[model samples]
Target chain A: MNKSIFYHAGCTVCVSAEHDIVKLVGSENVTIINIGEQKSKISEAENSGVVSVPALVRPNGNVLHINFGAAISDLK
Target chain B: MNKSIFYHAGCTVCVSAEHDIVKLVGSENVTIINIGEQKSKISEAENSGVVSVPALVRPNGNVLHINFGAAISDLK
Candidate 1:
């Protein structure tokens, strides 16, 4: 299965969401891209249609905008 | 003086920061760019070295990464 792209920014909200998402999809199933530390990833995130951090790009190329206080059960 | 560029994502944190920043420099002194609503501005935000939302680009072209709970007085 293709690894889902997880665009992170290292912020508190992003960090928590990352943990939740990893648990939901398993770390091996997700590719964590820290755009905050790697500015080059900013363009990659933009290309994925991520205007903000804590975004998830599924294997099918579906983009999910995870906002603050997002519940793990709400993740798809 | 040139208008400072403010990169926003329309999130709660970004909205609060926008309010505080506009108050600090006044609306006339800052140009708000909502990358969330206007995905086209994502490139502009990336160009300004903004990996996260609530970023401020001073008139001199210095980038400020504003995180959650950032003190308004700390803005420069």
Candidate 2:
């Protein structure tokens, strides 16, 4: 748990998390990355092993924990 | 109906989707966005309202239909 939490919020994740996760954890604890604009960034996140929206960049920064696409349930 | 589909894959979603969604939908129909690198694009994806990993941008280009992170079932 030494990694920085990086969230790649797309449309669905943003709308849901903005109204859900953001409220649950607050924006302060997380880094929300709007990944719908850049092709390179998106690629980078994937290379980092990111596969979904609302992902939690593990404290160690080794793996990403996805909150599911437009997750109906929370990742935590 | 005019909307373009976008995928913001983090680590979890990527690992799962690479074996799940990617295999189901293949990589051509979807444009995966690795949002773990650039901070700006992450914000952009959020603005687009993308909320999921395997999100389907409606042909109308209004709402994003997320495929859910690490989806067990296919979006189609």
TM-score on alpha carbons, each prediction: 0.44, 0.36
Worst 10 residues of 2 chain B by lDDT: B67-76
Q: What lDDT tens digits, residue by residue, belong to model 2 across residues B1-76?
A: 3224455456564555444333333456445565554445555565666554544343344433433563212221
Error of model 2, residue B15, in angstroms? 18
Query: Could you tell me the lDDT of residue A15 within candidate 1?
Result: 85
Residue A42 in model 2: lDDT: 68
Candidate 2: tens digits of C-alpha lDDT, residues A24-44: 334665555666554446666
- Candidate 1: where is the Cα deviation over 4 Å? A68-76, B1-76
Off by over 4 Å in 2: A1-3, A62-67, A70-76, B1-76
Encode model 1's per-residue lDDT on A1-76: one tens digit a residue.
5788888777788886677556545688789987777877777777766666677776665555555432222331
What Cα-based lDDT does every candidate model obtain? 0.67, 0.47
Q: What's each prediction's clash count?
A: 0, 49
The digit string of per-residue lDDT tens for model 1 on B1-76 reads: 5777888777887887677556545688789987777877777767766667777776665565654432222332
* Standalone chain B TM-score for every prediction: 0.83, 0.50
